[model samples]
Target: MGLQPIGRRVAAACAVVISGTAMTLLLPGAAAADHTDPPCGPAADACINLSENLSWLMSDGDVTFGPVPVSHGKPGYETPPGVFQMSFKNRDHHSSIYDAPMPYSVFFNGDIAFHEGSVDQQSHGCVRLPHDAARTYFYDLEPGDVVEVVP
Candidate 1:
């Protein structure tokens, strides 16, 4: 079939509806269940090596992950790159970048943490991932473990 044209406004509305539906379908619900920690790392918490950075999360001696994209401080307030231990965690969190709710945040450093972030690079000093990825990171991170944030 020839290209079916949609007017600008109609196309935009359709986009919104489609996106909203997708979000609804993906939303975590009652059926969502917690995954037990794997017998060891290298599975869900397996650290993936990256050319730029290495991300990590530990649920206990038994959990951790790595090499995920994360945003750091804005122009002048850049996050210091180094090894730091996780200090805080919240399954339900409010983002500073956007008022929207972030389901998981594992603090690897004071004020600086890892959580779901806006679609674009937007954060003060937090490892931002897609919502699902952040949830996974949160579920896997444990307090007092090192999460290396690199430059």
Candidate 2:
């Protein structure tokens, strides 16, 4: 057969095996693939570690950060995952529920936003934090920053 596209896995080499020692190196294969576009690193000053903080309740419709007030959903009905770009910013727009005005809205993954939301792990599946948490998250981020929503 001619050279056809075949799935290839670079076998784990003994020299590259991760051992009991602290060692940092560029990974092989898909290791370089950005989990989200624009590549979010804690050092980038634009990364938000969403997966580490909350759970995704696709059926419930919100997210909860302890001690932070609850927030409701945005206008759109779908929460997207994977790499997405921040579309816009809304500081005064009202949420669909709770009737409480949030101070910040960090829109990412298309219409999905990581804004001041309920601290209950609800919503279509967006990572929701409290007002202060959201402010801190958004404040540290600029437009066009990449966000990762992992399960």
Candidate 3:
């Protein structure tokens, strides 16, 4: 009777160890699955895949950061899909036309910019990323850097 409890504990410990090892073995594959090669290739500074709702920063044809979740304009206000260049940057930008706050903005096409916004919600003809991603992208891109938005 005394050994029965010890045996159960030993079995549980072994199960835990096996489960942990399995997770460790699977982690690399899972991370690899999360990343995909940017369609615009490594030369492009940034790529936004609207179909995937994904964005990334590229350098020398390699992804330096991202696969971050982004939100684009809703049905009525569709974000224009095309290749553009980063035209301007503003760390504390506000939209006078819409009277809305647009923080960490990186403007690519006219009034359309990549800025901090709710990832779960659509924007008004803008690419919206989470706060951290918006800031990272804003800093990563320079004026004249290529930004491709693809369907």
lDDT (CA) per prediction: 0.49, 0.43, 0.75
Off by over 4 Å in 1: 1-67, 95-100
What TM-score does each of the candidates earn? 0.53, 0.46, 0.76
Model 1 C-alpha lDDT per residue in residues 1-151, reported as the tens digit of each score: 1122232111111111255446432212111233332232432222312223334333334332332444556666666666566788988877666566656877766776777776366456555676645765665556765555435
Q: Which candidate would rank higher by TM-score, 2 or 3?
A: 3
| Residue 144 Cα positional deviation in candidate 2, in Å, after optimal superposition | 1.0
- RMSD to the true structure for each prediction, in A, is 13.6, 15.8, 13.1
What local lDDT does model 2 show for residue 22? 66
lDDT of 3 by residue, 1-151 (tens): 0112132112111111255446432221112358676677555788888988888777777676667789998999888888898899998999998899999999999999999999899998899988766766766788999888888
Candidate 2 residues lying further than 4 Å off, grouped into runs, are: 1-78, 96-102
Candidate numbers, best lDDT first, in rank order: 3, 1, 2
- Return the clash pairs for model 3, or none: 42-61
Write the number of the candidate with greater lDDT, choosing between 2 and 3. 3
Query: Candidate 1's error at 100, in angstroms?
Result: 6.1
Residue 66 of model 3, lDDT score: 66
Give candidate 1's error at residue 151 in angstroms: 2.0
Error of 3 at 114 (Å): 0.6
123, model 2: CA deviation in Å? Answer: 1.4
- State the weakest 10-residue window (summed lDDT) of model 1: 8-17
